[model samples]
Target: MCTTKRGKIVGYCANELPCCDFTAKNTGSCGTVRVGSSSSPSAVFQSPDYPDFSSGDLNCNFQFDISNVSNKGYDGIQLNFEDAYMEGPGFARHSPCETDMIFIRGFKYWQPPAWCGNLTGYVAVIDKTKNTAFLKVVNILALMSGFRYKWRISVSLIKRSATSKNSETEMENMENELYPSPNINYADIQPQPEVRQSESRSNHRSRFHTKRHAPIFSDNSEDEEMDPIAEPFIVNGEDTNITDVPWQASIRTFYPDSFLKMASKTINNTDKFNQEKEGCSMEGRHFCGASIISNKHVLCAAHCFHGMTKLYGFKRLDHVKVFLGETDLCEDDLVKYGRKSQNYSIDKIIFHYGYDDIILMHDVVILKLKEKIKFNDYIKPIALSKRNKVYYGQQAKSSGWGLTNLTAKGASLPTILQSTGKMFVENKTYCDAFLEKGWAASKSLMASYPKYYNAYESVFCTSSKNDSISKLVGSGDSGGSIIVFDKTHDPPLPVQIGIVSYGLDGLESKREHDNVFVDFFQSVSFYRDWIDLAMSV
Candidate 1:
């Protein structure tokens, strides 16, 4: 008989207590090892005789029940892997758990994959609602002498206050205090720009002109004297007020001087390279768009950072800059807006573990800012849509500072932010059909689309109802948000549903005349659990 204290097996009848009490009658076989409430809130568990080889074949199971703990309000369990060393994948590389592996359960949708080999720095969080969780370690190919495998995991209980649910509400309430009145007139509040009308029109004309059209104002005095106050031409979209889409963010990247020096040696055009170098040094170029999710965290496309790392040497945090609360990038908007527009440095970037560059799977990433943002009327975070909800055929809006014309030879960034008026969520079947046709016609797409294109549902498509060019997302809009209003709220709060991932124009074989203008966005609902987990950490 085993000794018991307060219904918890304290020790065996004769020997010292095991790491955990085995459920089976026999000493060590396949059975659950229950941890009593008397154990510390956080504890480290290790393989038998850790740091040394374990004799004979081994199979172990440990279970943790949060209900038995003193604190019933505990949110979840966090498993931090301090060390792990085991036999890796088989010769075929097909089965990662062919030899030795660790399996974790009770995380529901966020359950991590079976782990093997060196797994230092890995972390997994399991919700307490599941109550009971099991951690199993198995060694299938045990040697005659012994098995040389070891692992150390630190398990701790997490509090609900640290999770995204409360943090999101706190952030929203803090932002609401900054802007008491929602109907404030932005035009009356913002200062008028001091720029000359002619110069402003000239700037607009230069940037918006396409390769197919000659200069709107030529050397002729009559053309130059044309009414300067006339509305500046916009290709397909209209200018949007900063307050209307407060969550919009501009993700900029700067290349170091060392990188420019190396690039100069390879490029033949010294003049063009010199111009690019000047642009790289001053103000940093905007690479992608993002949406503010909280005071310190913003969401964007993972490809914006990963896709350019090789060519641009994006290894340092200092190279990235995030600008918020401003519509115009040309102005000293910080001084003009007075606390409304500010630039922030990134503290950390967390990408979805399953992100794939080739097929653009799970393309979203979260960025934590170095300083907490103070939200105002022109700067606020957008709420995320509920998980597993479908919003098919719903009308949504997208905003960005990307190029308005893709076919234009001398196209440049717009001075003001652009807004796609109303785009509808497209049918997945139709979008897939279009992609298949493109793949059949283009050899480049065929090479990348075969492995994961058909069954992938993590991305959704959007297109203009009238097929207007102005409503399409352009090159620099890769990380912007696809927002839909939740009518359930009294004021109909804007909820983010997607992150701009890629477009048909991203294809290598894309033609200027290609009428298909569908843009793909990383579905936010599908990854809501991952987002919550990331934010909690």
Candidate 2:
């Protein structure tokens, strides 16, 4: 009889199961193995009971630790798969692997592709910064009456030559020199706010605001003609000021006094009351971002308001406010900045008719303010990009008070506004390919957002070649502006081109490398007509 473990037999004991070695005692389960320069430079790992079909279900985990390899002058580690044969397709029908799968993790800088079903002769390289790598083999229904799976992989440390190391260092230094950091203190250089509106400003609501006009481009021009460019944006970002991005707007959702009172009466705990009060305040309520288009209109992501509706019911619009000319959200910081921030109640929010939350198609909203805004040096509206223009390959900038680091514990919203520099726009073709490659490794994303490909057409993608803090954007950055310089104007006008939309989640951001960090934005030019129609109302 075979010994049982975790609803499965512990390998084929004494040929009780077919295709098993009669002489073997226990031929399965290799839990964890530590490998480094101290022991060996290379090691081979195989599925439990190699060359034989193991009895019952299989759940094997193998971890490779090369923590000390870098200290010994090794620059990286390489995984060469000699043989890989597992259950192929047909099980789930939707996913590449359903009944049986192999998951690889623990690489810091590189994202390894999904591994399953005859990946023979495959090679994966991990940077020296990563200390460990994990491989997990899972077979859901590997029974005596079902099919079995097996694989074998060889891992070896890679030692760089002296010349190669020097060349790599020189290349890194050159890249850094090409894109110098902008370490300016934006708050120190902010222009003093004017005491009163000028006569010219009084006559016109805004310098950049245009009259209600018909669509500049016809519907046929909706198909974007893009030229691929190399660049990227945001989780690791720099501090910026409202003077730099005067059009930036903060969309906040606060709890009403009535709801707070009702909550205080319902819950008698003092700690809970204070917590709720603080959390429901204006500072805590900063949700999404927006960009000023006119004195009474701002552009934002529809999902921001959509999510609020789901949380606070249909009356969510009553609790929402738009803050302009603000850098820091803290009360003390606002006072220190001479109270430059202006808060306004929203009169109405118009979401795109084609807005689809599933694929995030037409994820845009036009927020009409109850009153006109008084423009000043610190607060101004930005010009919209022309419908015929596509700024592919040009550098772009994005600003928001979003989370600085996605991996940080709890909500990590920065007090001051964060901006990304040295980022470039990518074409739709490149964006689609990158999305497909990146999403292929994540099974959960594939399962949840199956129609993610539909987003490629209506969105603009941004990325950076060099690994910099500016390559990422976080949770609260939605609806912010992705501005690019339009040289067609005399002085190269700053035009609002894209609206910050969706991107990789926190877990996905961690696995992204330098060039692979990509963020999606809604193309402003694509929906220029819709924006004009909404603004006219």
Candidate 3:
């Protein structure tokens, strides 16, 4: 009987009892097969259902391991594909990339250039620097002749004495060009602090303040009307249905004092305000929100990783984790409710080269997970905006676990994920008007922050859709998504347009105060090319 668990084919074990022959052993599941060992330094790996891989749509992965080598000067490993047959999507150079191809990873590049067609007799030699390599073959369409119907590969370990000096030199050169050293000096990595603000500046108040008003107009006339299916939907209150925004992710980082504190346990607003005036002193443990873009990557604001360094402390990757598939942080028994969330450590972080802590421009950052995330209904990537040009008046939604009441003290933050819809302002000019004039902070504070001076440069602004009770993004909402429905796809998917960055406080940032300011976000469309580069690497 076929064995299926967590919506995947585990093996072909009979009676669903995990039999040996056709069944994969633990660590041997997930479309993966391990090969090679110290005892037998060489082995052959055949396509799934071997010699007959064409029987059905095929998607499989094979991994070569050489970690068992104990010798001090072990050379490396070599992989040779014999009679390789992979039917790519099309004959065109770029089109075939979308089809049935064998993808190789853990090497210098994302995919090997040699495995594009049904050719045979291709060979790859890996260096000893890396202990693992992967090969993924995907064939989605039905049978197509002359395409890849089947294939076989040989994997063998190589000792220093096994290969000639010339071969070793060639492999070393390739490694240098493809995968350079992955060593990163953690101590040397420091956040680029705000340019204008000195370390002595008061953290409680914005240094730059401005008081100017300008007439602004909407550019909706140039906006391409969105797809009909992309029309807005309505939801009441704060809690959102899990299915509503599957791309939302909780971006959490460890702190000495908890950023999230209970109302009864929180210090008085006076005490907290006094602490801020000294420096950016933060409570231990804080969480922002983010948006998933791929199985291995999520998009967030740069500040999530490096905000208020002196107050929050210099950040490190070890303190960060990304949580997916959960709506409530208070729920202790998630599996019982059919909700299984996964936590992934940060493997790498790429911030926009132009990111500025002072003006907060180019605030986007891409986080790479240590392992690829398994996609499901509760967790998915949101599409990037496809429109080459800008648009206004389209209703977008923002979701996070931010404060529900600006007036409350420590009891303000919500335990459950909350979401609300807002409308995009026409252009940067229109957005700047509100940012420059409506903030409760003084003009001097806005001036101290140069990022506030040029509001339209790299950010987009939005206001609440519901007129009765103004909805705005607040602290803890930073890095969350601003999404719009995309009717381009079959069922119309939500495409992310912006990343929440910061909010303007209403008059005072103290307790019992409201921040009556339009929310600003880093424009996703403006950095599409940058996002693509970050994801590929």
lDDT of 2 by residue, 94-174 (tens): 233444555555533322223444445444444322123231211111211125566677767655544333432342333
Q: At residue 280, what lDDT does model 3 achieve?
A: 32
Q: Residue 225 in model 1: shift from native, Å?
A: 33
**What is the lDDT of every predicted structure here?**
0.56, 0.54, 0.50
Shift in Å, residue 42, candidate 2: 76
For model 1, how many clashes? Answer: 1
Candidate that beats the other on lDDT, 2 or 3, i.e. the better one: 2
Clashing pairs in 1: 236-470
Model 2 residue 304 CA deviation (Å) reads 0.3
Clashes of each: 1, 11, 24
lDDT of model 1, residue 178: 44
Residue 54 C-alpha lDDT in model 2: 41
Off by over 4 Å in 2: 1-234, 257-284, 307-315, 332-334, 435-455, 468-470, 505-515
Higher-scoring candidate on TM-score, 1 or 2: 1
Quantify how close model 1 is to the true structure by its C-alpha RMSD in Å.
16.0
- Model 1 segments beyond 4 Å from truth? 1-163, 166-235, 261-282, 307-310, 335-340, 408-410, 434-455, 467-470, 505-514
Segments in model 3 whose C-alpha atoms lie over 4 Å from true places: 1-237, 255-286, 333-336, 409-411, 422-426, 435-455, 505-515
Candidate 3 positional error at 236, Å: 8.8
lDDT-wise, the better of 1 and 3 is 1
Q: Give the TM-score of candidate 2.
A: 0.49
List model 1 lDDT by residue over 1-537, tens digit each.
331321224345546654323231222333455553535566666766566434334576766545456355555566666665565544431233555666665432333335555445444455422212332221121211123466677777656445476654664454445433434222332211121111111110111111111222222323322222111122267788788889999887666778646655643123311223332323665657899998788998765664222233222466788999878766656555564577899776665544444445567778878899987778888888677877776777788877655443333457678886457777666455544443333334543433232224566766563533436675567778988765555445577899886654221123332334456777888767667766665
RMSD per prediction, one decimal?
Answer: 16.0, 24.4, 24.2
